[model samples]
Target: MNIEPTILDAVNKWLTPAFDAKTQEEVNELMTTAPKELEDSFYKDLEFGTGGMRGVMGVGDNRINKYTLGKNTQGLSNYLHEVFPNQEIKVVIAYDCRHNSDTLAKIVADVFSANGIKVYLFSELRPTPELSFALKHLKCQCGIVLTASHNPPEYNGYKVYWQDGGQIVPPEDAAIINAIEKLNYDQIKFAAQDNLIEYINTEIDNAFIKSSIENASFNTPQSAKDELEIVFTSLHGTSIKSIPAVLETAGYKNVHIVPEQAEPNGDFPTVKSPNPEEPEALTMALALAEKTNADIVVGTDPDCDRLGVAVRNNDGKMILLNGNQTMVLMTSFLLKEWKKAGKLNGKQFVGSTIVSTPMIMELASSYGVECKVGLTGFKWIAKMIKDFPELEFIGGGEESFGFMVGDAVRDKDAVAATLLICEVAAQAKAKGSSVYQELQQLYVENGFYKEYLVSLTKKGMEGLQEINQMMVDLRENPMKEINGQRVIMVEDYQSSTALNLLTQEVSDLTFPKSNVLIYYTEDGSKICARPSGTEPKIKFYISVNAAIENVSEITEAEAFLDQKIASIISEMQLK
Candidate 1:
């Protein structure tokens, strides 16, 4: 067997006395029997991306193991101390249903406590958004949640949040990375200071649920609540308790849970993958909904952050709505309800990502509200809320089935989103319509916008080089046209510049620098290309739109837009 010198050095470090016996044994076995796997595992130290550090669970510097997590927590602890030097530092920690999530949460709490920082740790598994809410509700300086979001069972992650309850962004993220690099494996403080740790559960759950209910806009009649049949599946994740509790508390009587997927299990035994974005993940829920004649079917990812929904179409057949459709429906509903309540005082705004549909901008504009477009993550949207303190943030979402309601929770919250979606359906019912019909009505008022996302996964070290090269090639050779449509403008987020191809004018962009490129066509079409920050994948977001005068034109408009997207993909030769 052959191995790189650097890889061999990393392997030897793991075999030393600093590592646990179990980890050392695994390393020894891998070196003797599985050199390739060992090399991949130890080739590089895991770096924190926009969603924090995440990797496959294994025994190596690159994996999400005890040593790596300990080092990250220690680094965060040190950074928090430096940032809040004169105050008593406190942090909140929560875990999901992933393997060793609870164990990692304890280790993190221990490390924080060992550093003389107060730790508020959940007694059991909880949704990711609750961690964000707890961070603000408890007035903590920093927070950590052990989750890989919607990743596969073999993966786990660590996410760091600031006091604003959003994932760490900008200078703070870079500074924390610098601090982490300066620490060695042996330098991690894992010892426990029992006195500094506090276990919380019911109080936080009650508070979160109360806040969610209070923030919901209830325009549906009592009959809508009584007649709405909802089928919810948590996909064996942490929302098993909170989601149902909220629905029942909100007076929804016909809510049914997919018994097979209700329990919180990290293995995610029922579905091929726990991610609701994949149609297969919702297969069981859809079947149950059909059997029960349900009006709406909702499923959440493992951490309960992203939501996927299914509704009966005009044909009365159950069909899953894409993330963009869900976002459009939710945003339109919230904006209209706000206006009806006379809350549209021009001091309110909504947010969306560059990859999201532009229809949200039109919807907000119709209500005299501002729509802000940020980079791809919910953290960026949360930052928008903090940056514009004068404006009331109504709600916002992305193309990835993640939505944030109100300003209580800074991250994309599936729990609150689920409740609000149900409310939308009920309100639609009260108007002698369905959620699907409401979506069509939205299109009739605002032009029809269709969005599609294609992700190409490139794995391992060699794959990383391929992904980087793809981005470089796209940036160096800008596309003048796509699918016979003239590209009017090209926005390079990395360079923070927008170039008008027709006028040959280059202007600076106000948003932060990121490795993303967006092309706008003379026709109403947008194409964005970006590499995933948390995974080894590159994603292309294509949005094309046309005017819809009535509901009859939806099918034709969608088909036309679909063909346009296909032509663009073919021209780019993306496979």
Candidate 2:
């Protein structure tokens, strides 16, 4: 295979300047052994999507490398210079436990420093949210974290933030992408003054840990920590270094690490993807939990932005709770405790994504605290907090295991999430009730809401065509029934209209236009289909609800609901 003419130009440019000898060597090796791979790597540049740059880690225009990182930093620097020309600007940078994550951070730091911006670089790998928190804490002009979140080990990413500490959106996001598009190899500066870059590690780490612990409901003594036996695994990610320390500092004595996954290996040796939402990812932790008779097993992803937990149910089987279940448990626990402590001064509210379980809304309504539903992203939740100053944000999470407990961070903070989850477990134990028990009680009070998400990946240009066709099919031939129940209403978010099909009436959606579609059935079922904004996949979210009289009825009700949803999925040919 021959390198495309355009790709050869990029390769020649990289080999000549800025990039190092090792990168050139790697590129030459790929050119020799896998010319096609080299072409794929160099034919197109890694894009700055709604998030930021993310792709396989390698030495090419399409890959995540020093050049790409440097270019992105240069673009952001240029944008910041124009946005706040007269102001002395500071930027925060953090990395995770991924391959070349630290190196990428250095590249970003060098570019920012070269552009005359002060950089606060973390001395070691840390969670992503802390970068967001540090952005606001230091009042920096911008922030970036070198992480791919829960993506596979072969991947690395860069997430950009504005002065508000939230992910870039709308005009700013488009402006940044435009700047990046204007960049070339010669335009990115790499030389840096050592003094302009500050190394931050334990000092900030300690402060972040204390802040997270302080947000918890209670701090148990080491002696009483046995009341909650937590089996936690970092899954060869950054949390292995910080989570246990944070939990121990929060007075949890019985926190055990899955030995196979305790080390920070970018390979993520134990699991297929190292994502906690996947049951297979928790196999090792679950096995250890059963052997140790642990009360709960939790795992954080590679970057530690998202968290996954498995708890012992009433039937004595360990089951992983979906993202929705976790949010419901954590949100209700936080609000209930706040109300009990007389801290709920009527201005407190919680938020979640639109596709998240309606259980959160019901739970919030039960306590008289408002629950705001934004589109599917943690940044939107953060935006809500930034928009509403009078309303204190209690906590917000999505169904994908990402959560943020306080206004300390704009993105999901796994460090804070880990601490708060353990605290919730401890508080439940102190009440002589299990976390599972609390979930059951909440479900009884509010309707039993269950949700399932299916993600279908379409690769290459051909896959993109198929995805577009599928969306077209859904919009043109909307489902009239799901699981034998009639769909009463259809909400087309892209058109910003909600129509009562039977009544032939239409209304408006309060949210902005997005490419999401929702169908609500009379039998209390909601089905949502949307294409991912950042990835090459279209996701379907199915939510169903039922009534449960007691804990004993949970198993049967769950089974019935599962059957109902499975039938609908089959009918829709989602699989």
Candidate 3:
């Protein structure tokens, strides 16, 4: 195999004395025996996206390695010093169960401490949300969590959180990127100042668990909590550290953990992938639920920021609730509780992404709470809270199996979300209803909405080209209709414009510029095509809804939506 000139240039640069012997040896090995691998690794640098930097672990600027992460930390350090000049800059760090996360986290800590910054490092693996809370709880300027979320086992990542307990946004993201781009591998500081670095564990954990309970607990009666039998699986990830304890403190006692997948293993041996969004990832949890006749089943990704839930339907079979379904259920319950407490006076709101179900609007409108739609990242939702401090952020979530109960932990938090769902389930069970029944009633009152997501992964340099071409093709040749429905509107986020296909009218969209395209049908169907910013995949989201007369017509409503989606998918040739 022949390596390209650009790859060879990056390869030769890595062979310098600035790189350690171990890294140099691995690079030489790839050069001689694995040319293709070498090309893949050095083709380009790993860039941060909406969720931050995530990629396979290896020895390249393009991969998640000590050098790349160190560069990021060093750049962050410089940026912090610039932004918070002459102040004592402090930061916190945490890691998940991914391979070498602890080591990578320590490397980052060393970089910060060497730059005369105070560092608070977690002594053990912890969920991602705790890092966000810890940064704020400790009054630090920034935080970092080493995790790849729910990607494959070979993947690891670094996510940065700002002072607001949210991921960096806008000018910050751009400035940090500029700092990192200006530096070379030799400029990163690797020395650790023991006096400046402090190891932390229980202090942050206790505070986070307490805060989670305080935000998520709705005062479900103790009797209801005991009656709500639950099964949970961490998918061999990090949630096992906090979720059970949070549930216990929230008055939930009948919780069962899937023992086989309870241990924090980086390999994620029990499942093909650690993502809870896939039903197969929750197979063991479902089995345990069936064995124990559990009322509800819940699971989380490796980082524990997103959760998947299953509940017994009216027919007595446990069915997994998609992200949109859970979003609607959780938001509705929160709104209802707020109304009962007289917290809703047009001074509160909920959040959803453009790709999420429009039923959120219907649900929020009925309660007189505004629903804010943004780009497809929890970070954007977090931005909403910071941008609108005068109004209360009751709750918010995207269709990607992530939700945040409050702004305490600005990003997606599964630990708190799990507890919130348990409260919902227990409250429903006490009222002679279940999650399934509640959802049916919601459909009967509101409209019946179903959502589907298709993610097509494109790996390596060639694959990136293919994915880019796909988006370009869609934009250059816009679609006028799908499933025999007239296209009423087209919202292109990149252009920041909404084109009304019917009247040829155009209006401006007040959203961040991103490569996303959405088509609105005359019948209220929403079809969105977006390229994922974190992973190398293009996602197509389909949302279709129909009004239901009553709960008895739910089956027919679902069938009609299903047929509509299938026809839409077929017409688009997505499959």
lDDT tens readout by residue for model 1, 463-569: 98999999898888989888998999999999999999999999999988998999999997999999998888999998999998999998989899889989988
Model 3 spans with C-alpha error above 4 angstroms: none
Cα misplacement distance, residue 333 of candidate 3 (Å) = 0.6
Off by over 4 Å in 1: none
Model 3, backbone clash pairs (residues 3+ apart or across chains), number: 0
TM-scores for all candidates? 0.98, 0.93, 0.99
Model with the higher lDDT, candidate 2 or 3: 3
How accurate locally, in lDDT, is each candidate? Answer: 0.92, 0.85, 0.93
Top TM-score model: 3
Give the candidates in order of lDDT, highest first.
Answer: 3, 1, 2
Provide the lowest-lDDT 10-residue window in model 1: 213-222
* Candidate 2 backbone collisions, by pair: none
Best by lDDT: 3
Q: What is the lDDT of residue 559 in candidate 1?
A: 93
CA shift of 308, model 2, Å: 0.9
lDDT of 2 by residue, 301-392 (tens): 98788899888788778988989998899898888778878888779889998899988998999899999999888878888987899899
lDDT winner between candidates 1 and 3: 3
Alpha-carbon lDDT of model 1: 0.92
